[model samples]
Target: MNEKLMFRRWLDLASQNILTRYFEGEGEGSFAELPVRVRMISRFRWFMLAVFSFYGLAAYGAYQHSGVGFFLSSRQSLVLFGCMLLVVLYNTFYNFFPDKYIHNRRLMKVQAFFDLLFVTVLVHFTGGDVSWAWPLYLMVTFEAAILFDKRRSVIGFGFFASVLFGFLLLSEYIGVLHFIEVPFFEDHSHHTPLFSFLFWIWVCMLNGVLSIAATFLMNSLRHENREVRTSRESLSKFLESANDLIFSFTPEGDILYANSSWHNSLKYDLKESHQVKILQIIEDSARAKCMSNFKRVLEGDPFRVMEGRLVARDGSLIDIEGHLTLSTGPDNSVVLWAICRDITERKNAERQLFHLAHHDQLTGLPNRMFFVERLKQAQALAKRQEHKYAVIFIDLDRFKIINDTLGHAVGDSLLKETASRISAVVREIDTVGRLGGDEFIVLVSHLHDEEDARLVARKLLKAFTEPMKIDGNEIFMTLSL
Candidate 1:
């Protein structure tokens, strides 16, 4: 009994290990069932359904061929049917009420025991000496190997085979069954009791070979499946934990899937039904444009990029740049897998940098560097077109005196006000630049002549002559060109 218990425990462990390895290797979301109890119940239901259906068909066929009386006479058949029915009942109820048997180790062991009993009955019914039913023992051996450790599976096979052989010998000795006739070297004339005994020996040898082979094949398949599952799971983990907003959309512009970053960063949940349309999140005008672009991509065109504004859930707008590539499926259906980046901060920073690089930081006028580059380009264009351009350099008169008396901060404020005044006088085509402290330059392009430049400079000088308030002190300066 201790030995039997140990063997049973080993078998259980091995089967569980095989299942564990298979499930772990398959990949994430392989099993639809979440709770272990539910998964166990479902597995039990499936197993019982298959086993019972096979047994039911086999039993009905046997009764039809052999007659009900003959079937009833075979206690093996009765026992097998009864055990199969019990398995079906247990599994059905366990599926209905998973809490009862899902975690019951003792019940599982009993089920395994019944499985062994069923196999024994099958063996007896088929005539045990090298019959087709011997393969059924291999099936039982495989089940044991999957459920338990290698040692336990081996032990279980040996012990069960011994029991079967013992029953065969006893039944034959008591005349309950006849010993099968065996031939010698395929010659019926040479057949003898010795040949019969040898044939039985051969049956025993074949049973061992079949059991070992089945166990090996099942174990290898289980290991391979486990590896595949594990790899898939690792990949799923990476996708779920990734930082970038990973998402895919159908060619119809319906969102198919999105990772966690899409939900956390964009505050968009794809799992919801109302949010299925990708266009729903985009502004109406932009959505139409995007759809047109996506159509081009779906028509077997290569990768495309789109930049636009995305309105957030809170009604705030965010700038997004998406890099979209077409993923063609085996059936030639196109999918757009896009990685969208929030470029709001980057766009704002770029605009700020543009302002700083082109305009004077203090006075909001174009800086000398920007003025020089633009002037050179404009002058070349003007010369080609037989047009006129004017360049006027202005220096503030007695500006150093104001800086020395009223302080440089006051002088700087005055200069800034003076710049604003000059900017108002010039046309949009004219460019005003701050050369340095107390110095300014203006570029007038497409001008009639140098007279237009002089008139603009005179207006700027008169605008600055008005008494200017600098830090609550009045200061006056003349602009010299």
Candidate 2:
């Protein structure tokens, strides 16, 4: 299964609940609002269209009106119109064209060149030395910051500024554009051509200063945005790979988030439901206890833990140990983040160990220690019932003689057969225990008289007398009662 898709579904549900609470009691505000795909697409389209439209309108108005001597001539106006048309077409049809065509690196380079060419034409159309087109260099710097790496963007901006400066210096030297003359004295006659050169130098310095400042600010903002995106990506990756079942819940015990491990262990389809309460998914007995622990954590406790059973989808029980911690949000409300581990195997191992400790491994009957404990309880009950009881201790007669003649292996086989024969003669209410080698104990309770116990013991003795054949040898044995 795709784990990332599962996690995102959980987060979407959690965000819904959070938004509901945040807007609670405010009429018509209870509904959660998630940005839809269509809204995102529309916003992007509108933003790009607005930016290009605004620049196009401004250039067209400048060409038509010569206010402040910033108007372009016929050739410059035609170039500006062509550049604006290209921008409009690119933004409008980029989504329609295949991504390979729209995002071609060669095409981008061509667009950038045309953009610079239009700016240069506008500079020349106006008075080259004194035109306000110098401020339009901000657009070039902005494009560089958006479209290229920091070093490349800086280089692009520097190159555009150099070319524009060179054109301005050439125009001033060739007398194509009248240079501004600064009066060294209050008399016009004392003014020299050196004054005009100094004035142009000041204009150049101002243009350089403004362009660099705007570029630095734009680049800084872009860098900050990149860092934020990187941090978010790293956090998302860490959450997806985490082993523990991490979750958050409401104060009322509604589930907010459940990690992949939780769904896999419980075999539940968490994605199918939007809001699941803890009690709905957990076992009945554990529900109250789990909710209590959740409350304690939500009441500002840093850490609280509880162990209980979680019901799986197939109605089987799973042992779980849960840890909870309270986290305070920006709004001063409490949120419970919990981590749980499946302990089914550990619990099963513990039960198996307990069973092994009390029962005999060979015969699957009670061992000596357990028999003694049961005997004490039985003796107390027998006293209350006012019944006669007898403890029959049995030993296999000449058992070692048989072992020495045949082998201990044969002796062990005979002992096992003897125990089974004795057990068959005793009542179900009676207790049987193997004390040690060749010795066994039987506690017969609820007997009417001593004769009842004697009959059982005699039967056990007779049963052993029926010779047992081991390793092709016929052996006879007796039971001591």
Candidate 3:
């Protein structure tokens, strides 16, 4: 069993070695530079040499009656071995040279022509039509299919093999060449015409069919390869033409690639792109968060959607939102990839909506809801830090009466003037708001004492004591505190 296993292993290795060039040596290039066909041809020659040596040695041993029943007679084997040796010596010149003539179909056809003739010789010595060696003719045709670029060349070689095989069989049947049948098998040295005809048909059909099949297979593979290359190019073009900022970075924050949108927005050219880093474009307020998220993803966390402001070329910040993908690059290095959309316009729209929700539509002061939230925030601060703060409330006396008699235009004008006066009286850290119907509130922070609040209230009342000119109508508005 061990010997059987070892023999099987040897056969596998030998077959792989012989076919290595056919399967792996053919590379992408012009036909003239396709070096694999050269290697394949050399490998085929070497394999044939090994077969000849093995069979010749066996035939020599059988000449002494000590070998297995698998070899031709001693005289026949000697002649065949000598001829094959000359062929090998002739092939040696080709092996030592570069494969510059592989593209030359005439030279390739010549090689196939000689190879078929030698295979015919192998069949002649080993038993002519009845010899298993006849199958080598088909293998030669297959080799031609691989080496020749055109299907017509392969078919031509196959046709040539059929002619050589037919001549050998017919000559032996008619006694032109002495028929040598297999010694181990039943001898058919004087085979009938019908048997010779049938065997010749089988050999020719196999060679022809194998030739067509091999070429078809090669063409299909080439078509598939072209399709794959085209698809890859299409995807590359799509990435370059996309509107969103697509980018990739290394673990050290070095920029690997940035699409056209990213480059144009950052105002970095192709030449300067290599010098730009990911952190350089990150808004300072968002840098720490961005780095933290990057570290988390590097440590095996899933991809994260990062929101940060990117500094543009004109010193303006763009709100960018994207998901970061962590992948292992070549040699297993960490790569951070992102496809971020510039959300600056979207963020600006959201801010406007927020302002409309929280501020007065007319005067742009904080509305009732916003003022209450700030009051609570101030209340929490005062409690936490013992901070002094106060809230002052004021209402315009008989403001509705002015709206009913002099019209709402004058009433709106007076309200607008009052909001500005109150805002002007408060500190920058303070909050001013309107509660509608000529009512307003102020949040005063960092106060010294209760007396400070009274002083601010008095300052506001004295400022409003002067009449406000609204729509060219002077109206004295008294505040009810």
Candidate 4:
């Protein structure tokens, strides 16, 4: 149990080291969340499978040519089978073991050394460096470039492989290890000893060039990959912490992704809005117009400031102003990217300012400017319809006296009450405006005759008969038309 625990701790530490080396400071939601060691192991597993296939085919070809079972005969042949089994066992252990070493550089170095030794034995028994399996040495050098930190390490691994090959060739030339006569290279083996030795050494030097070149190329690719990951990390941090609502949607209006600000502004949790439709956030009355603009944007039009009311999770409408852009995703699918800013407070302030400019502050009634515009509109309608409309100007009697006696607070309350009473007496279609202090205008449009205006004036007069209660005091008021 202690041994198992120790192995687990070692694996965990190894994985953490690999992550720090490859994925540290990577952006949120990046592929960096996957363990680098696990990714390396996954790639290495495929390399092992390719090696297995190559060796299996070589053994089958040997058996077909020699008319002898490759694994059943000589010690070298048995060792070849043993190497194949080792590859299989290693892959299986990596898949099944409770504590597997992943991207463990030290462990890989040891395995690579053993592989070099095993290939050297195979090369010696199969008539030295002319063996077709010589290219497998380059594979180890490439793996070294990917797994190690420097180009020197890759070259060192390649030199180790070559040295083992050289020692095997030297042992065979000196007759220290008996060279098994293989049928395939029988013609090559009949060459003079001196020429054969020089040729084999030359072949080893040629393989060293190939190994070095492979390492150089692989290292360049690794450098490029690291740069791309760094750029991605930087971009991800910017998007994740941005205050604007940054999100993407599919062409069909389905929400594809949303950032932290989007969730915060919309008051929806990440999981809750996973499959939400983009149009669902827009106010019902504005959706048709918004969708039209969205379609236009997707059709290659540049974005304009699109103002819409978005319904939040709490069912409050938020005024949002932003633009949408069409961009292709990493997967080459067209997506509509959006960056919307919350302008609810700004919009509310604008409405309040507009109200202040056009309406009375105390009475909540249209001021002089708005009342004049309404009067013009009413006159235009009356002229178009060939009808008469009456505009009755009113001034409250004794209002200044009441204001002076009761203070400005009571005066403001009485003004509000007067506006409400005048509003109640007028028809919904008529305009009742507070023109100025104690001055009002009632525009009765589409009236049939002068008598219709007098009846509305009578109603306004009677509405003031009920005394207004202000500051716990009932106060009487009157207005003249």
What are the TM-scores, per candidate, against the unseen true structure?
0.58, 0.50, 0.54, 0.78
Per lDDT, what order, best first? 3, 4, 1, 2
lDDT of 2 at 102: 32
- Whole-model lDDT values for every prediction: 0.68, 0.65, 0.81, 0.76
Candidate 3 worst ten-residue window by lDDT: 25-34
* Deviating ranges (above 4 Å) for candidate 2: 1-79, 93-106, 150-153, 168-242, 249-260, 268-280, 326-335, 349-481
RMSD of 3: 9.8
Distance (Å) between predicted and true CA of 135, model 2?
A: 2.2
Report the C-alpha lDDT of model 4 over 1-481, residue by residue, as the tens digit.
9999999999998988766444442232323222343345445655667876787688778787875544335666677668767766765655554133444656656666766665666666566655566666666665555555566777778777777766776777677877666555556545457765776677568667866786677666666777888888897888889888888889887787888888988899988777678888999988987898888997887767988888989999988889888889765999988888989999999999999999988888898999899999988889999999999999999999989998999999888888888899888998889878889988898899999999988998899888899998899898899
Q: What tens digits encode model 2's per-residue C-alpha lDDT throughout 46-140?
A: 46457656875886677457544433456655766776676567545533542433346454445555556656655655444445565555555
lDDT score for candidate 1 against the true structure: 0.68
lDDT by residue (388-423, candidate 3, tens digit) is 998888888989898898997777777888889998
Q: Candidates ranked by TM-score, best first?
A: 4, 1, 3, 2
Comparing 1 and 2 by lDDT, which wins?
1
How many residue pairs clash per model? 17, 0, 0, 0
